[model samples]
Target: MRVWILSDLHVDASPWEPPPGERVDLAIVAGDVADGLTRRAIPWLAQHVRPRARHVVYVPGNHDFWGTRLPDELARGRDAAIAADITLLNAGQSRIVEGVRIVGATLWTDYSIGRPKWSQAWGMREAGDRLTGMRDHRRIQTRDRLGSPAPFRPFAALALHVEHRDRIERILSEPHGGPTVVVTHHAPHPRSLPAGEATGPGDAAYASDLSAIMEGEHGPDFWIHGHVHASRDYRVVRTRIIANPRGHDTSHQRRDGSWADERENPSFTPSLVLEI
Candidate 1:
């Protein structure tokens, strides 16, 4: 019943070894496992991937899209000599593990396309290009003029909304009565300003759906995400919102060759241990 949540850890730094004998039932990697090309597999990755825990679940973040084939490729370990111990969750289908119905999607809110395009898997630039074109020109202008940066995006709003709801529906549609765990690479609900440790500008749709799911009788026990690059704990209705940003490399550089962690320092690493 204990789950460790981690997300947004850019692979520039290796994951630290968990303390010996410290038991974790499940590890939920929200996403952003690496920035682009995760060259050296963290010694811990292959080690802890299929830990003693009953299940280890992974979701893709926007950054992990860098050095890859289809977004789902990371889940499947398409590359030779590369193997991930955890179960990679991508769009489509409900996955059942350890008596839990787990459903996930790597889909982020696509602002430009005005819909959740599956193409975001083609790295950031290519996916961004596709999304940019999906935008509704008129709505873009209207939102721009009003200075209202929509969280779910206006043009793709209808499609994104449907996509979000469908994901929940898919999870609920599962025949098993076991409790479910929803994992995503983006924030699932709204938080106050100073939105500490959350995903970027398109998680509103997921957030909205999360609330609805939690309100229902068949709601998940917990919802975990990792896109924000920091660690935050909150709640969506009765669902506990756990976000862990795994990206640690800081883009901000100093003349003295020093950097800061993700939130402020250059060496912040996101690693959470969950027990399911």
Candidate 2:
């Protein structure tokens, strides 16, 4: 079971062409497949990888939620997943693929994760206005079709925690029958970040609880995530953490396809050719 893991494919810059001749059993896209409006990017990625891999699994990232309500975001994302003929794992969805129980979620960030320093990111903005750029403070809320008034902060650091707390808790508690795989858009654990990555305030917060879980006796056979654009693969207390990202245009991984020749940069896909 060789798997290709990619994350943060910020469309305009990132391009991925899997290595030819490699037998890919599964293709796992951690998150950030679109840039707010190009929702189709999700299904495009799925459709592209389907011919090569037996199964495709995906999770959603923050950018995927821009300008959309919680309900519509999930609905559209799930629909794209289905149309792409791929499995969509939102906050607490699980599926059995290739003999592994795959569990996935957005898991989100809570300001207290590691007491991150957001001193440089604070700001006061008007409601319903555009929240541009890539900062938590830049998240703006929009009206949902369900008429549920959205929170003032669209990307509030702890929003997902409050909304999907119970769902994630249940997922974390489920028993694994055999080799299991856990996937999330945010960093699963602090250590999951490579030496140079996972430095953002948001990353610090998102990695804490999940990182704590990786330290426990019961963890997944494989743990995967994106968010922190840098590509990193390491083994923690119990599981192997893989963060394979496509990153931006300047990213070394983007200069040349990582599939066939990763010699230019080993941080890209096929980070591991696990034959599980």
Candidate 3:
């Protein structure tokens, strides 16, 4: 099966637009399927993207649940989608499809622990307070609105990180006779991050386990990830890794200003597609 993989679409519901190619049998979205997974928008995704593919699988990233609870249908419809042959994975599980075993997990990074003490000491408390709107009601905004001094918690954050990695391990233990594909919002490989702050899911902790899984005699043939928005390729263990960012924003274009103009717009690209 020829499968196409992409992630971090971060779609907003207005007019459902199809990708610039023929529809295929499956679309695997790692995360950020829509701006929000609320009661309203989640259904819109089901209507717009799900029906177009024979099998649609997804995992919720930090963005999907950013400051919100899981939508009511996110679970039920997820199961329904699986029943409809559409698989929706959250901070869990593995799904087998057409000889390819797809495993995935949402975004759970160390940053969400709480703001770093150092950042708080280094003028971050006041900034976080102001940004969080404690001083002004209207000032509170989504975490995505800012890009510095991210929340941090060394211990609990570490625990959450271990949990997700353990999930990946547990799934890999099962038997699926074919090429395996692992989908994760936070890239498990070291080369995936930008210089920002060594944040995001601490891949360091899971490096050994990840290496063992991917390097196993029957490991995955390919691995796809989303979080770090860099379009690059690498090899981890015996698996080929592909990291595709959602897109580059031209509004802030001078820092590097090198992305292709045609590919600069914000749009949804189905995470994974398979052709029979």
- On TM-score, the leading prediction is 2
Order the candidates by lDDT, highest first — what do you get? 2, 3, 1
What do the candidate models score in CA lDDT, each in turn? 0.52, 0.63, 0.54
TM-scores for all candidates: the values are 0.62, 0.76, 0.65
State the number of backbone clashes in model 3: 7
Residue-wise lDDT of candidate 2 within 1-276, one digit each (tens)? Answer: 677777777664455555565547888888777655235556567656677768888877766666555556677777767777888787767888767877787766554434444422331122113544234334435444467765535245355655554565466577766677888887766665555444545344445446556666656778888887677678777778888776665434434656333332346654345556
| Backbone Cα, N, C clashes tallied per candidate | 32, 1, 7
lDDT of 3 by residue, 75-116 (tens): 554666555555667665787777778887763443322234
Q: In model 2, what is the error at residue 30, expressed in angstroms?
A: 0.1
Pick out the ten consecutive residues of candidate 1 with the lowest summed lDDT: 134-143
Give a tens-digit lDDT track for model 1, residues 194-269: 2532244333323333456667766677777765555566776667776655455445567888874344323333
Candidate 2 — which residues are off by over 4 angstroms? Answer: 14-16, 116-133, 136-146, 149-157, 162-166, 193-206, 251-266, 270-272
TM-score of 1: 0.62
